[model samples]
Target: MEFIFLAAGLIMGLGAIGAAIGVGLLGSKLLESTARQPELGPMLQTKFFIVAGLIDAIPIIGVGIAMYLIFVVAA
Candidate 1:
């Protein structure tokens, strides 16, 4: 049971770190491209948000799962 809790915490923490790194790398590339093409700023910004949301999705789901494990399963 304690191991389950630890594993759940690790899942959420690692998920968040992975998402952050993914979004950071994506945004960096998008910014570099936008800098190269100023006219594409609007389009790139929109795409950035969509990509960011997608990157965040897994981590957010991990958080939900962690909560369930901590509050429900461990209860």
Candidate 2:
């Protein structure tokens, strides 16, 4: 039972860390690309937002699974 909690915590922690790194890199690359071509800035910004949402989904799914482990599986 205790291990279940540990597993859930690990899941959430790692998921958040991975997502943070992904978004950070994504933002940096976006900035770099926009700096290279100002005319494409708007189009790049649009694609950046779309990719960011997909990156964020990973952590959200992790949270859902963690919650299930804590509330349902551990119960």
Candidate 3:
């Protein structure tokens, strides 16, 4: 039980790091695309928000599970 929880904690932390990097890279690309085609800025911004929401969802779930394991399961 302890090892499983420990591994999950490590994986969740690493996942958070990767998620942050992924969102940063995604925003960078979105900026470049918008700069290249200024007229499509609104469309790209909307799409970026959608992708950002998707990226956030996964990490949020991982964090919630991690918290539950640490606070509730370990108790």
Candidate 4:
């Protein structure tokens, strides 16, 4: 039904917004820390990448599900 497509769009949109906010805040803090501690830049960057992956995981899954719902289920 049309509702299914709407639900999929909401899921994808909300997930993207949440992920964007989380990553933006996290990266901002990480940059601030790196600026304060230049010597630890490498270590901070490594951890930032790890955390970025974790933060992105859920939204990526939501995108996949949304694609499935929009293309397969709704079709």
Give per-residue CA lDDT, model 4, range 26-75, as digits (tens).
99999999999999999999999999999899889998999899899988
Per-residue accuracy of model 3 over 1-75 as CA lDDT, tens digit each: 787588668869887888899899999999999999999999999999999899988878887888888777777
Runs of candidate 2 exceeding 4 Å displacement: none
Model 4: ten consecutive residues of lowest lDDT: 51-60
Off-target runs (Cα >4 Å) in candidate 3 are 1-5
What lDDT would candidate 3 get against the real structure?
0.87
> Taking the tens digit of each residue's C-alpha lDDT, what string does model 1 give over 28-67?
9998999899999999999999989999999999999999
In lDDT terms, which candidate is top? 2
lDDT (Cα) of model 4? 0.92
TM-score winner:
2
Preferred candidate (lDDT higher): 1 or 3: 1
TM-score of 4: 0.85
Q: How big is the positional error of residue 41 in model 4, measured in Å on the Cα after superposition?
A: 1.0
In order, the Cα lDDT scores of the candidates are 0.93, 0.97, 0.87, 0.92
Model 2 CA lDDT for position 14 = 100
Poorest stretch of ten by lDDT in candidate 1: 1-10
Residue pairs in steric clash, candidate 4?
Answer: none
User: Model 1's lDDT to the true fold?
Assistant: 0.93
